[model samples]
Target: MTGPDKDEAVERAELLLALRKRGIRDRLVMRAFEQVPRERFVEPVFRNLAWNDQALPVDCGQTISQPTVLALMTTALELEGTHTVLEIGTGTGYYAAILGHIAGHVVTLERFRTLAEAAARRIGSLGLANVEVFLADGRLGYRARAPFDRIVLGAAVEEVPSALFDQLAPNGILVAPVGPPEGTQALMRYRRGPEGLEQRELGLVRFVPMLSGVAAVL
Candidate 1:
């Protein structure tokens, strides 16, 4: 391989090893992380650190989540090949691209129009046909395409929004970070069943706050 390709390969390998050491055991989740180039989702200034296990700022004051958190959330979702996913924060579109690799379809919503447009362009350039990016209020969820088999929120909130639960299909799984935006949050998973929504706390995490309404920026 060329020098850059070899370096990227090495970085990817090391990253996968680190994730495995951190107890990320799902093969599909690992493969998705391996396949998606994190550099493509980060700002040019932070491209060199793309493979590092840390969140990095993108446009619109948002951040692409750390690889470990993304993997954990993906694992919690328990996605199947046929599942359609609703992603609450598109950010740099990196996570949505990863979801595209594992799920049948991904509908991602971003409050910032600029971020949504950039994410759409990036996902399109990658030819990730299964993923769609939209500029909208994520808290409201996408009712037009209600009944998603899987839903993931990249931002943190005090609690899971009821609107999202209404959009989840029976037996669907919704994974999100729940807590105050300034402090540590719990990575939670909610499964819709015959009885109701079943909740599980995966781990503590930190993420940006889940905001309401669309961004005012043109």
Candidate 2:
């Protein structure tokens, strides 16, 4: 930790240790979290806090989800190497990077064009060719890439959008927080079945409300 480079390395090591201590033991997920430098996904003003296990403010008034939350959601998806994953609410593109590590392909949607562009550049810099960034409303879900094996919404939606549910392949899984925009929300997982969608509420969590429509400024 004497020089900037050394310090950054030590910080990343400690962050990984913290994640391990928190029971994030899945080798693939842990490796993905460690390999993707959280600092690169955060603004320079908040770079020092990137290693902290908390949400960091990102562009468009959104927050890059806390590491624990990200792990939980990603784990819930149960992504297989060949599965195609769709991520709503791209935010800082951090989640997409992690998904790319686990899934065969990732299609992420963002409402803010500026945030989407920045995320695209960062993902490109990392040489993640599997992640396709879209500057569009996530609520609509990417129809062209329908029947996703796993769908993850980074923001909290008031209710599960029927459109998104329809896009899931049979037996596919979707994870998102559902409830009122202002109050507490429950992270729920839905698995498509022949009978219908089977839901299992996981836990209580807070997230920025998933907005409708695109941001004018982007």
The local distance difference test score of model 1 is: 0.91
The best candidate in terms of lDDT: 1
* Predicted structure 2, TM vs. truth: 0.94
Q: What is the TM-score of each candidate against the true structure?
A: 0.95, 0.94
Per-residue lDDT of 121-193 in model 2, one digit per residue for the tens? 9999999999999988888888998889999998888888888998999999999999877777899999999
Give lDDT: candidate 1, residue 36: 91
Model 2 stretches with alpha carbons more than 4 Å out: 1-6, 216-218
RMSD of 2: 2.1
Model 1 TM-score, all chains together: 0.95
Count backbone overlaps in model 2: 1
| Overall local distance difference test of candidate 2 | 0.88
